[model samples]
Target chain A: MELSVIGKYKLLVARLYGELDHHGAGEIREAIDRELMRRGVRNLAMDFTNMGFMDSSGLGLVMGRYKKVSAIGGRLIVCGMNNNIRRIFQMCGLQRIAIVADSLEEGMEELDK
Target chain B: MNKMRLEFLSRSDNERFARTVAAAFMLELDPTVEQLSEVKTAISEAVTNAVIHGYDGSEGIIVLEGTLDKNAVKFSVIDRGIGIRDIEKAREPLYSGKPEMERSGMGFTIMEAFMDSIEVESAPGKGTRVTMTKTVEAEDEG
Candidate 1:
C-alpha cells in the first residue's frame, strides 16, 4: 500500500484497492510512520474509502497511530470508512480516541480546529 | 469456485490470505461491498490469533479453510501451538497475551462484531481452532 500527501496534513490516503488484513497493515503502518516522522507532522488522515476489507490488524494499526500522534500532540482522523470498517471502529470505541468524519475535508477541519 | 484451504506462514501473510478466502467464499452470495469487509475482518482476527498468541509468536503453522453453504460463509483457522488456557479470558475486550507487540487485544471483539457467530475449540498444549460464520443479508432474517 502506498500513500500520497494532500495538503498541510500529510493526507496518507491508501488505495486499499484490495484487502486490508494483517499482511497489508504492516506496509501501511510503515508508510504512515515514515511520512509522519519525516513531515514532523501530527495531523494525519487515513482514507479508507476504497479499502475493500479490514481485520483486527487494521484495528491494531489505528490504535498504534493514535498512540503515536497523541504522544506528539498531533491528531489522527479517518474518513470514508465503509459500513463494516465503521462498525469495527465503533465496537472498539475508537470514536473516543480518533475522530471519524464523513469526508477528508471534514476530518481535516476537525483536526485543524 | 471450489472451497479452498491455505496454510499461513506468518501473521502478516495470514491477513492477506484470510481476506481473499473470505471474499471469494462470500462472493457466492453476492454480498454488498460492506458484507465482504465484515467477513475479511473476522477471518483476519482468527488467523492473527493463531499465528501470534496461539503459537506464542514462535514457529508454527496455521491452517485456514473456507466453505460456502446455502445460508452463509464459514471460515476456520486451526493451529497447533501454545493453546490458550482460558478461552473466556482471551475473548474479553482488551485481552492480549502480547502487550509489547502493540496489540490492542481487541481482536476477538472485532471478530464477534463482524461475524454472525463465532465458535472456538481448544485444549492446552494441543492447539486452538476458531470457526466463524457470516450470513448474507438476504438470508439473515428468519
Candidate 2:
C-alpha cells in the first residue's frame, strides 16, 4: 500500500494493492487509521485505483473509515473502483455510504463541495 | 474434456485462494462481470463453510476440481469433514450448523443463486461433497 498527499487541507489518498481479504484487512485497518489521525486529515479520498481485489473485510474498512470521518466532523469519499470492486460495493450497499466516482478528480470534486 | 485440479490445505487463506482459481477458470466462459462475481463469491462462501463449519476448524484437505464439459463448466468442492445431517435442511436460508463463527448461514443459498445446478451427497459419519455446475446457455431472440 502506497499513501500520498496533495492539495491544501492535506487529503490522504491511499493506493491499495493486492487482495483485501481477512488475511490482509488488519494491516489495512491499522494503516488507514494511523494515517487518518497522523495526517489530521478531514476530507479523505481513497483511490482504489490500483486495488485488484476486495472482500467483506475490505467493505468493513470503508465502513470504518466513514465512521471515523463522521466522528471528526469531516467527510469521506472513495473512487477508482474497477468493475470487479464496484460489483462488491453495489452488492454490499457500500455505495450508499461513500461517494463513488469515475476518477479521483470526480471524487475530489464531490469531496471539495 | 479439459480438467484442472488444485488442492489446498484447509486454512483461512485457502478460502480466497479457491475463489481466485474459480474466477480464472471461468474466464473462458466470457461471463459478465456480475456473473463472474457471483461464481467467485459462491465459491468463497462454500469453501469457508466447509472448512469452518464442516471441519470445525480442524485440519483437512479441500480439493477443487474444474472440468470443461462442452458448453458448460462443472466444478466440485469435495470435503472430508463431518457431513450435514439433512441436505434439504442445510439448503434452507438461515440454517447453519455452526453459529459461533458468525456465519450468516447463507452459504448454500448464495451457491444456489450463482450456480445453475448444485448437488450434495453425504452419509452419517461420512464426509460431505458439494458439487456445483454452471452452464452458459445461449439466449434466444424469441
Candidate 3:
C-alpha cells in the first residue's frame, strides 16, 4: 500500500511496498498516475522488491497501467518481484505486454536502452 | 480433519484478513510456501468476489468456511447479495462485470489456477457460493 516515486525525468521509477490488492490498487494507481502527470513522464519503472503479496487485482493494475502508458507510446517496466509474484504475472500472460527486469536498476536501464 | 467458519462484513479490508485466516488454517496441512501462497491467493479472490460482485458495493455478510481433510483443504465463500445473472460468463477469464473499477475479471481464473477444483453456485436474488479445494502435494521441509 506504500508507494514512493523517485528518479524523475521522462522515465520515473516507482517503488511500491506492502500488499498489492484491490483496496491498495486504487490509491497506487492514482498516486502513480498523478506523479506521471506532474512530471510528464513518458516511461515508468516499477519496483516491487518489498511487495509481500499480490492477487488478481494486482494483475489488473499492471495491465491497466500498461495500457495507459502504451497509449502515449511509452513503456512500463516491472522488476523485483518474488517468485510467487512472478508466477502470477506469468499466469496472466503479462510478459507479452510488459518487460520484467531483474532489478530496479535494470528496469531503469531498460528505459535508456 | 477440522472445520472452521467465519462470518464477516463484506469489506475490502477483510480480503487480506480472509487470506491470512485460510493460510493459518492450512498450517496443519504442512503446505509448502508455494501451496500456501496459492491457497491464500485463491481465498483472496473468492472472498473479494463475494464482497465486490455479490454485494455489488452494498454491505452484506460474507461467510468463509474452511475444512481440512487429509492433505486437501476445502473452503467456500458465500454471500447473499445480488447474485450473478450468468455463472458461466462470470467464470470467463477477463470478464469482469465492473470494468469501471478496473477489475481484471480474472478472479475466477486465479481461483481455478491456484486450486485443484472450483464449483460456483448462484441464482438471481439468491446468493453465490464458490467452493474450491486444493491439495498440498508438497510437504514443507522442516
**Which number leads on lDDT?**
3
Scanning candidate 3 chain A in windows of ten residues, the lowest lDDT window is: A1-10
- Which residue pairs show collisions in model 3? none
The stretch of ten residues in a row with the least summed lDDT in candidate 1 chain B is: B10-19
Off by over 4 Å in 2: A6-10, B1-5, B24-38, B48-58, B78-130, B137-142
Ranking by lDDT: 3, 1, 2
Model 2's number of clashes is: 0
**Runs in model 3 lying further than 4 Å from the true structure:** A1-9, B138-142
What TM-score number comes out for model 2?
A: 0.71
True lDDT of residue B22, candidate 3: 91
Q: On residues A55-85, what C-alpha lDDT tens digit does candidate 3 reach at each position?
A: 9899888888898889878898999999888
Q: Mind giving the per-residue lDDT tens digits that candidate 3 earns over B1-142?
A: 9999999999999999999999999999888888888888899999888888899878999999999999889999999998989999999988999988888888998899889999999999999999999888764469
Docking class of 3: medium
Error of 1 at B76 (Å): 2.4
Flag the better candidate by DockQ, 2 or 3: 3
Q: Name the lDDT of candidate 2.
A: 0.75
Better of 1 and 3 by lDDT: 3
Best first by DockQ, ranked = 3, 1, 2
Instruction: Count clashes in each candidate, considering only residues at least 3 apart in sequence or on different chains.
Output: 0, 0, 0
